[model samples]
Target: MIMKAIQKYSVVLLLLFIAVSIAGCGNQKEESSAYSIFYINKDITKIVKQPYEPVADITDTNAMIDEFLGQLKTDPEDVEYKRVIPKDVTVLDYSVEGELLTLYFDKHYSSVEPVEEALVRAAIVRTMVQIDGVECLTFYVGDAPLSDQSGNPIGVMTNDSFIENPGEQINSIQTATLVLYFADEEGSGLIQETQEVHYSSNISMEKLVMEHLLEGPKSEHAKSAIPEGTKLMSVSVLEGVCYVSLDESFLNQDYNVEEPVVIYSIVNSLSEISTISKVQISVNGDTSGVYRDSFALDKIYERNLDYVDAEVQGNVIEEGATEELE
Candidate 1:
């Protein structure tokens, strides 16, 4: 009787150990499960997030990208989002370096319609950058780098690159009023105008204001200080100073305008941002250059109210001058 009882106890112990081992294996598998990020278009203007789908566990980054792209070709299991990548396009190869990921695609990438280009690019960029350790992305189609409309190389793009505005998806957009300074019709002083702007969440407010200023003013009485055809290379803020980089065309001026008027127009306009205290201008990324023959471009500029034509009680008047009776 004792021998039979001992045999039953050993069998029970072995069953318990086997059950524990099976549970541990199951947990490990669950922890190794992978997820793929997808971008869904919001209102045809912006890209928004969708729930990530679980993918087959893969260790290699290239293989992981392949699986993600393959999944993107098919309709997502969840109905809330639709696939943006064209089925004809295929990923030729990819490489990962530090924080940047480069994707090489076949000729089908260029075959995407012009109207759908932005949407497709946004979708791909937004999806890939979400992965850990990937901060920027570059694209190549058949050994040729992607270029923008102006033929400028679209270099490494971060999450803030493609989206005009980055923020929560709201039903309506919010706008802010801006006081911009422009060259007066007479070309003697700066004219102040109030502009209503739709604030962009993806871009810095100062950059948006500079872009609008570059577009020139709508009012017939004011003129743009920035020369026509001048391209904005980049805009960035470091510490309290806002740095604006422009192309060579900024030096070309058809009308006779003072250096101060042109320089202060940008300085004062950008200084309206609460965080910015000064403005620095650069040409083609070079800070040391001459803007015409008058002002040295290397120096930082502060806001000068003397050049601005101030507004008084709904009437426009020259600074330090009283309104004369009409």
Candidate 2:
């Protein structure tokens, strides 16, 4: 039944790609799920989990994505902890080919302006695949994964911990380090994390930052907003602050209005999850200078630029603006 649904809906849902559906909230609860359903991002493909939703031992995928955004809201100031890198982004279909889960972004996804090709590859893939159960991930923008503008394969990295696992079975647990492990046909095990990577497991710091308005340690806000296949890349703890990095494609997605909701939940979740008091965020890397469709956003001359290459383009203008020549 699952395979049959994937084959049928995969083409139809993808082919008739609509921009946005404006449904009335009054009728929202009463409406059938088919009509009430939303497409997360145009390039992203989401097949709703009907009978068998993905079950995790430690945390469900939904909680992870939402908690990330929540942290963004509570601690917006902590967001700029790391120098933000700018990567060109696009949303693409997500598919599982054997043991690997491939996340495809738009075709221009690989052309990052700030980080080099090597750093882009490591940051995007390693940060995202750190989630439980996802052993290996291949990133594609459009039909092509990690390609430059000219359609050349550039940033593809295989997981060091990949075991040749296949096929899915029932949900069960293997205890080792408060982890929820599931078995695949291949030899590797999917480990789920319940407690935050903090000193204490009993505390709900992770829950507070995640904004679990509900009973469980899940995110109420961001989960309902972005489409599925969205993953939290990395939350770094440095000197009493949490620095979070995210997939570049996150900025290119389609939300009805106020897209920063995605970011807010992430930052807030981080503030709540761990002992860190502050949180900072950057999409793919670029901070104040990030623009979506390419505007001539000049780099502001801030006092604390660490790299020292802060110029309009790349030149160092020691004096003020030069006079126009005839």
Clash pairs, model 1 backbone: 166-202
Per-residue lDDT for 152 in model 1? 39
| lDDT of every model, 2 decimals | 0.64, 0.31
Candidate 1 local lDDT, 1-326, one digit each (tens): 99897544433221110000100111111133344455455334444555565454765666666666676667665565666677788778888877667888899987775435555666776676556556666788898876544443454555555434334431223468888888877666788877997643334566567768987986676899888887665565656787777778888875566778889989999998888898888876577767877677778888997977554312444422353443
Best by TM-score: 1
Counting clashing residue pairs in each candidate, in order, gives 1, 41
Candidate 2 Cα outliers beyond 4 Å, as residue runs: 1-222, 226-229, 288-326
lDDT of 1 at 137: 68
Off by over 4 Å in 1: 1-36, 41-75, 88-119, 130-134, 137-156, 161-171, 186-188, 198-204, 238-240, 253-255, 284-288, 294-300, 309-326
lDDT of 2 by residue, 216-260 (tens): 222111122322333333333444555443345556554342333
C-alpha lDDT (0 to 100) for residue 197 of candidate 1: 73
Worst 10 residues of 2 by lDDT: 17-26
Instruction: Highest lDDT: give the candidate number.
Output: 1
Candidate 1 at residue 37, lDDT? 56
